[model samples]
Target: NATAKAELGRATWKLLHTMASRYPVIPTQDERAAMKQWIFLLSRLYPCGECAEHFQQMLKEHPPQTSSRAALSDWSCSVHNIVNARLGKKEFDCRTLSDVYKCGC
Candidate 1:
């Protein structure tokens, strides 16, 4: 179960980061609104109950930074580091995000 949960988290973070990487550089207001709603829905619909609750709280504290691809990617890394810290995992360098999550699309 622990393995499955960890794998799920890894996969979810990958998806989120890749999406952030591909997000518009200067998103329209409608795009920004959509991204925000999508993130909120993610917190609400995440498969893991405890993880979802923690994500919801994090959202309240930090909210989504959808102003640009860079902003969203940086915000994603920061929140991911928050979770990593809580799990006693090493923090990822935010500067390496482009290298790490290359969607190529």
Candidate 2:
């Protein structure tokens, strides 16, 4: 169960970060609001209850940055780093995110 939870978390984070990477550089108000709402919904609906609670708290403490694709991507990386730190995982170099998460979508 724990291994399945971990795998789900990894897949979710990858999907989120890749989406951020492909977001519009200059998003419309509707687009920005939709993105924020999507994250909120994801946090609420995450499969793991404890992880969902933690992510909701993180959202309150460090809200999503949806001004631009780059900003959102950076925000995603920073939040992932927070989760990684809590799990005793090695911190990723956020500066390399532009090169790291391009999905070519």
Candidate 3:
């Protein structure tokens, strides 16, 4: 279990680089599947459609810094706190964070 968690931490590190942009943005499908899964796993964190759409556009253009495994773990933990602080407790769907939205694009 510890090893799996460590591998997941590594995956999250790879994901942080590939997932979200630094200036705030939505993410690609691969990114969303990983990062959003982290969100859902956290006791806090929810999705917002309007914010998600806006950020997606941002991510489509600008990318973020490459992340380390330790950095991502810290970042993910902070995201949980930040989301909880901003949005309060509520359920969000995994569907909202990815590029799978039917934009007809």
Task: Give the candidate order by descending lDDT.
Answer: 1, 2, 3
| Reference-based lDDT, residue 22, model 2 | 92
By lDDT, the best candidate is 1
Per-residue CA lDDT of model 2 for 3-105, tens digit only, reads: 9999999899999999998999999999999999999999999989999999999999999999999889999999999999999999999889878787976
The residue pairs that clash in candidate 2, if any, are none
Ranking by TM-score: 1, 2, 3
Give Cα distance to truth, residue 63, candidate 1, Å: 0.4
Q: Candidate 3 — worst ten consecutive residues by lDDT sum?
A: 96-105
lDDT of each: 0.96, 0.94, 0.41
Residue 2 in candidate 1, Cα distance off native in Å: 0.5
User: lDDT score of model 2?
Assistant: 0.94
Q: What TM-score does each of the candidates earn?
A: 0.98, 0.96, 0.28
lDDT of the structure predicted as candidate 1: 0.96
Question: What is the Å distance of residue 54 in model 3 from its true position?
Answer: 8.2
Which digits, one per residue and each the tens of the lDDT, describe model 3 over residues 10-63? 454345433332312534556645654554443132134443543344334432
